[model samples]
Target: MNGESKIKINMKAPLKERKFWDVIVIGGGASGMMAAGTAAKRGKSVLLLEKNSTLGKKLLITGGGRCNVTNNKKDTRTLLSEYKGNDKFLFSAFSKFSVEDTLNFFNSRGVKTKEENEGRIFPASNKAEDIFNVLYKYLGESNVTIQSDSPVVSVTKEKEGEYFVVKVKKGETVFAKACVIATGGVARPETGSTGEGFTWLEKLGHTVIAPDLALIPIALKDKWPKKLSGLTLPDIKITTFLDDIKQEVHKGKILFTHVGLTGPTILNMSRDIGELLKYGSVKMEIDLFPHLDHGALRAQLQRLLVEQSNKKLKNVLSILIPGSVVGPLLELASIDGETFAHSVKTEDRKKLVDQMKSIFLSVKGLLSEDKAVVSSGGVELKEVNFKTMESRVVPQLYLIGDVLNVDRPSGGYSLQLCWTTGFVAGSNC
Candidate 1:
């Protein structure tokens, strides 16, 4: 579970030594692993190729190392709806490998899961290594052949034999009856999501959507957020606006960064934030205490201040808000932090409450793909058959995971997409 654990993948020999593979999965990511394991389970010889030294590089850091395995929206209608515009296209895939099957597959492997807020399911152990281990173990048990540190250069089908030719960076060539491209889109470059798969797909005549950021952090125009870097505010409501016209309202946890805001709420809204930024400026009003209304918050602050009437305004306000943010926020409201709670003027107190309720900030922009949890573009959905995850343009060629242009929010939806599409592709390819 710690460091680079060795893979006991039970591979017969070096990847190139093999004469032929029934299915070649050109990515050792979540979807690739699933597709490879599923195909091997069906008695097909599967070859899993990875660019990384070890598999699941991105998996280890996902969910801050917790690894949200899947979202618990098991109902077909409800689960599909979370994917936004891709719901209709995904209905067939979900029907083929429902979220329930994902849970059962892991559960059958003895990796128990626990549900957190927003239906995010994580291993009870709270380690991403567990999830990786489960899939790796599945691949090993199914006798999957793995080739790590072997970057695939290109994939082309033989005109005469109809076999897919896979070229490795090391000048090794392998052939397969079918190929599944699970190479993820360009989101986390550190995780090997360089998007070579998109290039391959484009060459194979599949329409690839231009990649963009999704589930990313939003940079703030105000420098004050920089002071509260690493501070996490839970249960806050952020009302979004464009050109002073209200747009969307969201509520969840937000983490302050040196240049921007991140965390669940910001990531879930980042796609929309990116769209709004394309038109004009975006405004965000953060409500520190979303549970309480303006009058109630004022009354609560008044009570807390009365109990510490002799204390400094900053110290008294610490009980209502995060102590680390008191000084920066007080300066924003133009209220002296040294003032006594009892000596604070009614107007100044109102200003302090108003600032707490409506922390106005302008959206500078979204962080680039390096900060994105998942990207929004890849192979177009209309060009693929969801029932089998096969490319309409390329025969015996399938696309899965981030390589497909499915815009899904964070919180296990992305992983579920991987399991669904990979299993569907494995079923047919």
Candidate 2:
């Protein structure tokens, strides 16, 4: 039969069945859909349950609604390096379902993708809905049963056999020989990721690391830098320090938020900041002119002053920096903003150059878990069999996606983890 007809047949199948399914995947997000599709393609009976009214609600909003599908990096080691926590645990999963596999998987299913800067991939059509629709279509054609708006309250393991009884909120029970928990973390709660899966896993004798905000914006202790909100500086270097010791140095785009800092560079370093925050306060420094040395920046400022010696100090800096940042830089340099360029002192010129080179911001803390792009903590990696994504403690029970402790950068790595782990679990299940 054609693809359309096959989907119709699969969707028309009744929900009632006397026998247990081979695999019942919970949480119909990215990982759950992939697991269900893979299991169904293997001729194993599969069912997918989602708490949301529809699947891929979060997926629809990823990558600014374009859906970064996967990075173009082919080396498994490089891909694993992007993961901030538990990179070593994903060796087997990446081997089985690497970036190449993701590309081919989507390409074969009629969804084409393209690579952008830093090896990030987006749909060739530039639409996240296209990616979701393709996955949904594949699930429909593969006869994977999807029950939306069914929130699983808890999971009960049978005493006699290697099966699980999933208890839903509305008094529904599903028994399956194999189960995969693909529920995501508590990043975007409006997308139906309420962290319910973490609670369920904790009750089932699994050690769940308390989840925290990872790739979220940092709120500063002081409010002076808040005036620069919405200003984006490219080619900047951000160094995060804890207790006077440098922890991470990231180079990329940095955005000034109403509260503090964000963007690719800030978000990349935020994970380490989150870890350091557990101990004490963290400090961050932004090198606005990363490409220019102190001497070079000083020379540039001097040249600008020479060209505009008669103009007001504020007007002279208006050509070099934004209006909002000019006052702060002047304050940092201890220069009078009302003074003319010719009246500026030599020591003040050096200070202004130094201030422009490195701007300091003290981080009070990260945003709430709901505002986080991805959560850092989840099920500890040691308890999971990375090869098959199955639980070491509970036989035939698999875990994938954000439910694990693995956390990566914001550029498609998190979603790629879902595809890799889901593929491994489904293939083994």
Top of the candidates by lDDT = 1
True-structure lDDT of candidate 2: 0.84
lDDT per residue (tens digit) for residues 1-429 in model 1: 542356565443686478599999999899999999999999999899998887888888889999999999989899888888789899999998998999999889888999998999999989988888888888888898888888999999888748899999988899999999999989999999999998888988889999987889889999878889999998899999999999989999999999989998899998888899889989999999889988998898888788899999999988888988898889889999999988989898899889999988999999888888998899999999898999888888989999999988888999999999989998888
Q: Model 1's lDDT to the true fold?
A: 0.89
RMSD of each: 1.8, 3.9
- Best by TM-score, which number? 1
Minimal lDDT window, size 10, model 2: 1-10
Local lDDT at 140 for model 1? 84
The models' CA-based lDDT, in order, is 0.89, 0.84
Off by over 4 Å in 1: 1-7, 10-12
Return the clash pairs for model 1, or none.
none
Clash tally, candidates in order: 0, 0
